[model samples]
Target: MTSTPPTRRREWLAPAGLIALSLVPVLSGAARLTQLSTGATITADNARFFDSPVPIVVHIVGSSVFLVLGALQFAPSLRRRRWHRIAGRVVAPAGLLAALSALWMTIFYEMPASVTGPGLSALRIVLATVMAGAIVAAFLAIRRGDVRTHSAWMTRAYAIGLGAGTQVLTFVPYTLAFGAPGPVLHTVLMAAGWGINLLVAEIVIRRRARAMSARRGRPAPASVVSAPLS
Candidate 1:
């Protein structure tokens, strides 16, 4: 029996972590709208901006849809010309809708009114824009038969969209270890989530670049040579 490759083992870890993290919100029985700062509870009345359930629902549904579709993109069987084109048509619009919904929800719901409010909102806006641009570019690259570029951009977009899940995962450990209050802990976890996603994107880009370079450098398969007159 053959052992699993180290790369396969490593690849399994992220998806496993994502699966566990995705279930946390549901398991905790916390209101999806609740925002915690440090250990202290800030009442919904105090953070009136997030009181709307519509935006929260939109964000949750949009992100979840993106995550599920993004996972399907890794299916090797879908790499065929026909399936890839069909999937591209579906993914492009779905990704656009998800990014737009997340962006609008972020603006209308969760933004704070303090100094950091504008900054954080701006960051979310920028991230959403990046996600949208990456998705669009990925689609265009696929149309042009540029698979390498398409894969890279799509990975970047997916990474950013998945950042939310990573944030929740990081928060649990940090909150327990530091004993930080809810608000501060939430902020720290959000930052950590984006940071990790960016780091992952960079690592992926570098690896893909190296792989592409190696493929280009490899010599074409030579014809098998046999002894002529032995």
Candidate 2:
């Protein structure tokens, strides 16, 4: 059998598909908020959430806004435009709120007695803290006129934020195959979500850096330079 080759359209299509898939978790989480607000009975897996729903609600809503709006920033057609500049202004606050909300839930929410292991909790804490730090670093880099550094940092932070979206892919199959995972297994799955996204982001960042470097190193065109002397 022959393997199919990639094309430019496919390259653009891939991000569109990924952006759609990533929205699944955000939309699902948003739907759940109505249930929470109405005091409807959530499943056993989510019972503990009722004890403290505000943080979770804030996280989901803020993250939903960040994820949806942030996806647009990755579009090459948009990144160099004025719209990107305006979007960045809004994306920062949305991302920061999401990260801070996750931190609050990790630090303060009581885990369900059924799955009280520190595995997921610890992972959330670290990711939230790093994401928040990255957001601030991006801001500082931009303020210093280091657009490249700012973009790279923002990319990394967005990757970390994508972890929650990736969790559905990582956990659902295993949970279906063998029932809900224990603490260690759950931790491993969640870590994979972050690892996979961060790895991809690093690759893109390096590629962009190389491209930018080449552009800067290119010699001026002879036509543009013209004759030095009359």
Q: Residue 213's C-alpha lDDT in candidate 1?
A: 62
Per residue, candidate 1 scores C-alpha lDDT tens digits across 17-95 of 5555545433332344344323345564435333455655555555665666556555444454477566667666767
- List candidate 2 segments past 4 Å from native: 1-11, 42-48, 113-118, 218-230
- Model 2, poorest ten-residue lDDT window? 221-230
Colliding residue pairs in candidate 2: none
Against the reference, the lDDT scores of all candidates come to 0.62, 0.78
User: For each candidate, how many residue pairs have backbone atoms clashing (under 3 Å)?
Assistant: 10, 0
Superposition TM-score, candidate 1 onto the true structure = 0.67
lDDT of 2 by residue, 1-230 (tens): 96555653554564575578668768788677878878887777677578778788888878887887888887776787899889999889889999999899778876664644547787788889889998898898899988777878788888888887787888899989999988778778888889888888877777777677688996433322221111
The per-prediction CA RMSD against the true structure, in angstroms, equals 10.8, 9.3
As a whole number from 0 to 100, the lDDT of residue 3 in candidate 1 is: 100
